[model samples]
Target: MRNKLVEFKHVSFRYGDDQPWVLKDCSFCIYENEWVAIIGHNGSGKSTIAKLMNGLLFPQEGEIYINGQLVNDTSIWNIRKDVGMVFQNPDNQFVGTTVQDDVAFGMENRGFAREDMLKRIEQCLHAVGMEAYRLTEPHRLSGGQKQRVAIASVLAISPKILILDEATSMLDPKGRQEILSTVADVQQQHALSLITITHDLNEVTQSERVIVMNEGEVWNEATPRDIFKEKTALRKIGLDVPFVALLTDELREQHIQIDNEPLN
Candidate 1:
């Protein structure tokens, strides 16, 4: 059996002591090197779940494990080193004035030597296809470019798992495509476990596993093909089929012979 990289055991969380649970008994396991997508509507606890995975938040009633080690204050710093996160807004995440500086910030914070930091920064920028922008100001870069820089910053540390919380939501269609291509490149080459939280069905269609959350629980867990086939069930929970899936459904209705394989 494959080793589990992240685990949540009856995990639940709320923002305040008196508030109701935002996530309730949210238990799931992500394996080493797997690509997983968490889908849900606004206020459905998807963000909360992502925070828990990387130790940004701890469970109120249960436990979370990273690389088989239980996450607590004692182990959170180490766990954070192994798990990297990229939040939605590109502007908010950019701290370095230049692209190179931004990519090296995390390594610098971790006390890497100057020589090693530069080397890793170069390699990471190249990996994300942003080597040319090394000396450019981050403000001059496009949305997609900034996202790649954010990714490069995380990659410089060689994380075992990456969490993207709608990292592409603010980009244009072309920009989103560019960032996703970068994401594919990293996942393919590094075999890094990825957890992407997005409203876009297009993003989840490529995942090895699909998880749909509703009202703070795991409402559905299945392959993309299986989940898309149950359109009514998804619609009931305020989710829509992927545009490609809907188009395929329409064509199949008219007797078109299209392969119904899950899209990537």
Candidate 2:
């Protein structure tokens, strides 16, 4: 069995005492090198969970652990060293004047040896297929290209876990595909665990496991195929089913027999 990389035990949180709780006794585990997707409607507290995992925000109740260490003020930086996050907007992550420099920004902050930083820049850029854009300014790149650079920058950190918190929500279909393909290839090459937080149900079909959140609590956890099979249940929680699941339901209604379950 794979080691547990992240654990949330009875966690709960909110912005303040006056605000309502955002997460209510949420609990889950993400295993090493696994791809897990957290899906929920807006205000379901999915993004809040991501912030808590990396210590951007601490839970008002319960606990969060990363790589076997509890998340607190003192351990947050260390936790971040093992976890990389790419948020919804790729533009928000760009800091360098050029592509290569952008990839080096994190390493610079971490005090990577200059020689090692240069080498990692080349390797990460190539891994994300952004090598040819090495000299391009951040603003000049397309949305997809910018996200590729962001991924390259994160890869330079060599984190054990990567969190895509609505990473593709701002992109067009083509841009979304670009990021999805890039993430899959790099995850294999780097042996990194992936946590994708998204409301786009279609983007999550490839994950090894799916965690569905509703009203600030974990509603269900299952394999992607198993989760998609409950199209009616998923919709009742305000989540739409993927194309394949809907198609399967239609086929069955038409009396067309399918030999096996279909999940796209």
Candidate 3:
């Protein structure tokens, strides 16, 4: 069995004393080299979980562990080195004037040696297919290219877990596809554990596991095939079933047996 890379035990959180809980009794484990997608409606607390995992937010009532190291004040810095997050807005993440500079910024902050930083910058940029744009200014790149640079910046840090927090939401369809393909290649090449927080069902279909959240709680956890089977429940919670699943449901209503779940 794969070792657990991150874990949440009976986790609960709230903004303040008067605020209602944003996460309640949450428990789950993300294993090494696994690709998991977290899906939910706008206020369902998916992003909150990402923040908790990276130590941006702490749980009021439970514990969170990364590589068996508890997420606390003292360990947070160390934990963050293992978790790299790419947010929705690529523009917000860009700090360097050029592609190579942006990719090297994180390593520089950590005081990486000049030679090592140069090597990592080269490797990561190439890994994201952005090597040719090494000297390009951020303003000249497209949204997809910008996001890929953001991803390269994260990979340059060599984090064990990669969190894409609505990273593709702001892109057009072609841009979105490009980013996903780049992410897939990066994951395969590096054996990285990937956590994708997205509302796109097509993106969720690519993950090995699906986590559904509603009202700050985990509503369901299953494979894509099994999760899509509950079309009515999903619809009630403002989520849509995959198109292929809908077709299968219609065929079933006509008494046609689908021996295999098409999207599984």
Report the C-alpha lDDT of model 3 over 1-264, residue by residue, as the tens digit: 998999999999999999999999999999999888999989899999999998999999989999889999999999999999999989999899999999999999988999999999999999998899999998799888999999999999999999999999999888887888789789989999999998777678767899999999999999887898888999999898878777877898899988865554
- For residue 88, give model 1's deviation from the true position in Å: 0.6
Clash counts for the predictions, in order: 0, 0, 0
The residue pairs found clashing in candidate 3 are none
**Model 2, runs deviating above 4 Å:** 248-264
User: After superposition on all CA atoms, what RMSD does each candidate show versus the true structure?
Assistant: 1.8, 2.3, 2.3
Q: Model 2, 1-264: lDDT tens per residue?
A: 889999999999999999999899999999998889999999899999999989999999999999999999999999999999999898889889999889999999999999999899999999989899999999999888888888889999999999999988889988897888789888889999999899989888778899999999999999887898888899999999888777877898899998876453
As a whole number from 0 to 100, the lDDT of residue 98 in candidate 2 is: 94
lDDT of 3 at 199: 78
Which residue pairs clash in candidate 2?
none
Candidate 1 residue spans exceeding 4 A from truth: 250-264
